[model samples]
Every structure is written in structure tokens, then in C-alpha cells.
Target: MKIDIVSVFPEYFDVLNLSLFGKAQAKGLVEVHAHNLRDWTHDVHHSVDDTPVGGGAGMVMKPEVWAECLDELLGLDSSTSESTTEVDDVSTDSTAAPVLIFPNPSAPLFTQRDATELSHADHLLFGCGRYEGYDARIPEYYRAQGVDVREYSIGDYVLNGGEVAVSVMLEAITRLLPGFMGNADSIVEESYTGANALLEHRQYTKPAQWRGISVPDVLLSGDHGKVDRFRRDEALARTNEIRPDLIERLDCASLDKADRKT
Candidate 1:
């Protein structure tokens, strides 16, 4: 996959060069290009933001800068630029890889499902904004242009800018890509992977006798079926204790009587 990140503070993404994202690039699974929005500026000031027009407390990113930078990155189909899209499979062709607008309190909330969907894209462009955020005209204009643009939020919180939010989103999505993690099995057993959207139950490792509490014998009985049942029960109990709403959302058809006991 190819990801283009447009941000004023391109230096902030240096962290990407040292972590799992860096490893993914090295292994040829993904490529990331971080562009400095100022490179597209026209004036001596090389400014990318300006005071709000109708009366606002902070600055808004310039629309012209976004247009120029994004055009240079994801240019028109007729452009002769070196940048081009190539998908290996028949299913991926002719799709406009989306540019995600980070979700915020004022917009729709982002979710794990969104991450999964973006992971399959051939290209993804993340636009980072500070101050009052990018001029509203930018996304509006993109929508008019028939671009695949949408907003998503991480949580019910305010982030300083979309740069770090892009990083957070990449980290969330990249780990799900095949081989990005050390143990693939770990993903299936993790919290929020299956019917359970709540945290997984507590796990006990050796020393089995730690702090005068014994690990459950069912875990050590060498019975795989028993272990699976024990784990499922623990998962159900933990969900009921902490997030009953998630349990209620789960399909009860799969639950045996033992699972509903709690």
C-alpha cells in the first residue's frame, strides 16, 4: 500500500521511521511518503495558514496550499506525473483511494471497522491540520470534485492536529495487515476481534502459585476443549462485569447455558 501524508510539521513523523511502520516499509509491505505542505506555498513568507474570514479564534489552513499539494500527490488521470496507481488484483482497479478526514467531536466517530477498510486501499492520503483546521472549503471542494473524502474520529476528545491522528490511525491499521505482528494468532484472541467488543478476561502465567493465589486447574489440565471453554467463560464474565452493553450486542445463538450463567 502507498500512503501519502501531507502535513505542515513533516518532522513530527520522524517517529514513523523507527517503529513497526518502518519495519513494514523495509519488508516491502507498505510505502509512506510524507510531504511538507509549505513546499507548495507561493509567497516569501511560505505561509500555509491564515486568520479566519468571518471571525474565529484561531487560524485555518489555506485552501490553495491543500489544492496544490494534493494535486501534486493524487493528480488527475491525465497527468504525466511519475505518481500512478497500480493494483495487483482485478477487484482493486478504478477505485479512488480515499483521503480520510480525522473524525472529531463535531464529526462522526472513527471505529476499528474503518481501519480495516482503509487497510485494503491502494492509496490513502491523510491531511493534517492545526489551529482551527483546514479551511472548510477544501473538503467541500473535494466533494464537488467527486473525490472519495470522509471524516472519522478516534474518540470523544480533541487532538492538537491531524498529524498525530494520522499516526494513530496508521498504527491501528498497519498492525492488522498480514505479518506486521510477530504472532498472527495474537490478533484473533485480542479484545474486540470477535463477537466480544469488550476487554478480554484476565490471564495468569507462571508462577502459577503467585501471591498465594492458584491458577485455575482447568488451564493446566492438558485438555484443550476445557481450556477453550474456560477462556470463553472468562471472556463472557469480564464483558458482563465491565461492559454489559457489549454483551447485550453479542448474538446469543452462539452462547451455551454456561456462558449465560453470569
Candidate 2:
């Protein structure tokens, strides 16, 4: 995958070069570039934000600056006419055109399913908004140009900038890419993954007994059937207690008699 991030504080992403993400880059599994949004500015101050129109507290990012940067990155001409069609979802085909994303606090929450879907994209361009956020027309204009524009919020809270939200989303999306992790199976059974979307059951390592707390006996019995059942029940109970919303969304057909009992 090819990722292009536009942010005023590009240096904040330097740590992307230090962990598994770095290894993915080294192995040619992904390519990432962070660009300073000010580079697109023409003024002496290279200013990228201005006081909001009508009335507002913080400055809103300039649309002209974002348009220039995004146009160049998306390979679109500055004067290109807008298309009538608009895309509503990210295309899963790796050969599809690049998808444009913006992190917005009022947008739909980003989920693991979104991560799974975007992992197939060939290229992703992210515009990290700052201050009061970018002018709303930026995404509207792109959508009219037939770009697969997506706006997502990581959670319910607010942040000072989109940089951190972009980081969180980028990690979630990239780690699901093929060959990004050493153990692919680990991704399959994780919380919010698979058809069930339940929270993961607890895990224990060797030296099962510690501080008078012992690992479940079923885990040590060498009985695969009983072990799986115990884990499934625990997963159901945990999700029911902590995230009943996920449980409520579960399909009736996906749950067997055993799961229904849990």
C-alpha cells in the first residue's frame, strides 16, 4: 500500500519508522510519506489556516492549501471538472483508485471492519485537519470529482489535531495488510474481528499458576473441544458485560445452540 499523509506537524510521525510499521516499509509491504501542509502555501508566512467565517473560536484550515496538496497527491488537475457521481465506500480491490480520508470528530466511528476493508486499497491519502478542522468543502469537492472520500472519527472524544487520530487509524488499517504481521492467525481471532465481533477471551501463558491464581483446568486438559467451548463461553459473557452493543448486532444464524445458551 502507498500512504500519503498531509499534516503541519509531519515530524510527529517519525516514530512510524521505529516499530513493526518500519519493518513493513523495509519489506516493501507498504510505503508511507508525511508531507508538510505548509509546503502548498504561497505566502511568506506559509499560513494554512484562517479565522472561521460567520463565527467560530479556532481557525479553520484553508481550502486552497488543502486543494493544492490533495490535487497534486491525487494526480488531479487543478482545473479538472467535477464528476456527477460520488463514491460512498472504499473499494476493496487493491487495483482500484486511491481513497481519500479525513479524520473528523463528528463522523462515523472507525471500526475494525473499516480497517479490514481499507487494507485492500492500492493507495490512501489522508488529510490531517488542525485547529477548527478544514473547510467542509474540501471533501465535498473531491466527492463530486468521483473520489472515494471518507471521513471517520476514532472515538467520541475530541483531540487537538487529526495527526494522532490518523496514527491510530493508520496502524489499525496497515497491520491487517497481507504479510504485515508474522502471525496472520493472531489477527483472525482478535476482538471485534470475524463474524461474531465479540471481545476476545482471556489468555494465559506457561507457568499457568501465579499468585494462587491458576489457569482454567480445561486449558490444560489437552481436550480441544472443551477448551474451545470454555473460551467461546467466556468471550460471549465478556462481550455481554462490557460491549452489549456488539452482542446485540450479532446475527441469529451465526449463533449456535451452544452460543445461544451463553
Candidate 3:
């Protein structure tokens, strides 16, 4: 997949190119790019923000700069505002439209379900903001032009900027892409597998007996069928204790009679 990011603080992405995403790139599993938004600015100060119209406390991102940048990226310019706009490396696939998402604190929380869907994307573009926040209607502006603009948040609390959130999101989504990991089943068998639940089923390692405890006999028995039953119970019990809401959402009909009883 080819992913792009437009941000004023493009330098913040250095760590991405040297981490898991970096490895993904080295393996040719993904191509990630972070572009400076200012490169699309025309002002002497290379200004991309200004005071809000309603006398707000912080600056608002300029819609014009964003329009120009997006037009260049999407190759939709017919009497467009930019003179040097280039559509160089954006990938094209016969199967899908490009996805453009913005990271914001007020948007819906992302989940493993969303990550699974994003793993199939042919191209993705992330919009990162600084200062106070994005213009209230900036995302809408692009949406009006038929861009696949979506605003998503990491969680409830706010961070210094959306760059960190974008980084976190990118890592999560890209790692699920084909060929991105040593074992593709690795992600499937790990946390949030099959559903949006947190953490995989409990696991145990060597030394059947510890100081004052012992491994579940069902586990050591080497009976795959019994082991499966044992794990399902352990997972249900742990989840009920730590995050009951997840269990509440599980359809009783979805489980076998034994799982429902557990």
C-alpha cells in the first residue's frame, strides 16, 4: 500500500521511518510518505493558519492551502489554484478509491475492526493538524468535493497534536497489511483477534508447576479439543472480570452451549 501524510511538522515522522513502518518499507510491503504542508503554501511566511472568524482563542487551518494540496494529490485540478501542484507518486489501483482520513480527538475511537478494513486500502492519506485544531469545516470542504474524508480519534483525552495519534494509527493499520509482518497469522492470533476485544486469550509457558501454582491440567494434557475448551473458559472469565461490557455484547447464540454456560 501507498500512504501519504500532509503535516506542517513533517519532521515528526522521522521515528516512523526507523521503526516497524521502516521495516515494512525495507521489505517493500508498504510505501509511506510524509509531506510538508508548507511546500504547498504561497505566502512569504509560508503561512497555513490564521485567526478564526468568530474570535476564537487559537488559529484555524487555511482551507485554501488544504484545497491546493488535496487537488494535487487527487489529480482533480481543472483550473485548480496551484501552479506547481504535482501528482507524482500517488498509487492507482483498478479496485479501490483512495482513502483520506484526518486524526482528531473528537471523532470516533478507532478499533481493530477498522484496522482490518484499512489493511485492504490501495492508498491512504492522513491529515495532521497542530496549533489549536482543524477548521470546523475543513474536513467538510474536501468531502464536498467527493474526497473520502473521514475524521477519527485515538481515544478520549487530547494529545499535544494529531501527529502522535496519526503515528499510532498508521502503525496499527499498516502492520496488518499483506507481507508487512514475519508471520501474517501473527496479528490474527494476537490481541483483538476475530473481534474488537482487547488482548488475546491467556497463555502459559514452561515449568508446569510454579512455586505455589500449577498449569491447568487441560492445557498440559495435549488434547487440542480440551485445550480449546479450557482456553475459551479462561478468556471468558478474564474478560468478564476485567471488561464485562465485552462479554455482554457477545451473542449467547454465537457460542456453543458449553461456552454459554461458562
Candidate number of the best lDDT: 2
Best candidate, TM-score-wise? 2
**Clashes per candidate, residues 3 or more apart or on different chains:** 3, 0, 0
Residue-level lDDT of model 2, residues 1-262, one tens digit each, is: 8899999999998999988999999887778999999999999999999999999698999999999999988879656555622253333557458899999998999988888778888889999999989999999999999999999999999999999999999999998887788888637734465456988889999898999999999999999999999999998999899999998888777788998777
* TM-scores for the candidates: 0.84, 0.91, 0.85
Q: What order do candidates take by lDDT, descending?
A: 2, 3, 1
Question: Residue pairs in steric clash, candidate 2?
Answer: none
Overlapping backbone residue pairs in candidate 1 total 3
User: What's the lDDT for residue 219 in model 3?
Assistant: 87
Which lDDT tens digits does candidate 1 get at residues 76-178?
4346454454644333432455564543335676656667666667678888888788788887887888777877667777888887677888887778777
Judged by TM-score relative to the true structure, which candidate is superior, 1 or 2? 2
Tens digit of per-residue lDDT, candidate 3, span 1-262: 7778999999898887786678888876777788999999998999989898879688878888887887777666786565544343343442256788888888888876777777777778888988877787778877887877878899889887789988888887887766667787746533454343633467789898999799888889989999988787787888888988777666555577897687
